[model samples]
Target: MDGGVLEDEVNRARLVHAAGLVAPDDAQLAGALSASDDAIAEAGRQRRILAATLGNAVNVLNPSMIVLGGFLGSLRDVDRDAFDDEVRARALAASAENLELASAALGADRLLIGAADAAMQRLLADPLG
Candidate 1:
C-alpha cells in the first residue's frame, strides 16, 4: 500500500495513543479493534485516510495490485467492502478500474520482520552497502 500506513492519517492513531486517548499499544491498529470504541473509531478514520492517500499513489503509479501486511491488513480485514469502496471512490476512474488489493500471506503480526525486509531492500538495491 506504499505510504498508506506511514501517512498522517494512519499516524493520527499513534498520536492519540500518545495523548492517552486509546489503551496502550493501540497505535498498532490490531489489538484494540474490539477493546475500545475509541480505538475502533480511530481505525475507521485511519482506513478512510489511507484510502484517500493511497488513491494518490494509484494515479501516479498505476499499480495493478497493493499488498497489505501487518496492521494494515488488520484495517482492511475489519471491513473489506467499505475499504474497497472508499479506495475506488477516491482513485481516478481509469487508475482504479483495474486495481486490486491482496493480503500478505504471512498475516498481520509480522511487522518487525516485514520492516527488516524493507530495510534490506534498500541495501540490496544499493549493493555497496
Candidate 2:
C-alpha cells in the first residue's frame, strides 16, 4: 500500500465499477489495463502521483536513480512511458536530466535483501556479536 503504483490497480477497478462502466468482481477487471479506458486513465493518474512524489524526493535528495520495487516494479506492464514522462516533467530540470528510473532487480526478494542488509549492519555494529 505504501508503494505508489502498486496499490493503484484495486482503486482503478473500484472506480471503474463505481462508474457503472463495468461489473463489480467481474473477470473483465483482471484485464482492465488493456481493455478499459477508465482503467488506463486511472493508471495514468497513479503514475502522475508517483512522479510527483518522486520529483519532490529528487529535489531534496538528488538521488541519481530511483528503483521502483514491489508492485510498482511492474509498472512497465501498465504505462512506463507515461510514468517516465510525468517524472521528467515534474522533477527539477537539472535533477531530471540524468536521472534513471529502474525496476528493482531483486524483484520479490527486495524485502528479503533489505532485511539481510539491516541484519548485517546490526552485526557489524555489535562488537561482541
Question: Which candidate comes out best when scored by TM-score?
Answer: 1
**Model 2 accuracy (lDDT, Cα):** 0.65
lDDT score, candidate 2, position 64: 93
Residue 67 local lDDT, model 2? 85
What's each prediction's TM-score? 0.65, 0.59
Clashing residue pairs in candidate 1 are none
Candidate 2 residues 1-129, lDDT tens each?
455453453344444553346553323343454566766666556566667777888888888988876445554346677677777788899988998988767865677899999999999999587
* lDDT tens readout by residue for model 1, 1-129: 445445655764453573345544423445556457766777777787778777888888999999877567677777878898788888899999999986677763467777999999999999886
Model 1 misplacement above 4 A: 1-6, 12-31, 108-129
Residue 84, candidate 2: alpha-carbon lDDT: 75
lDDT of each: 0.72, 0.65
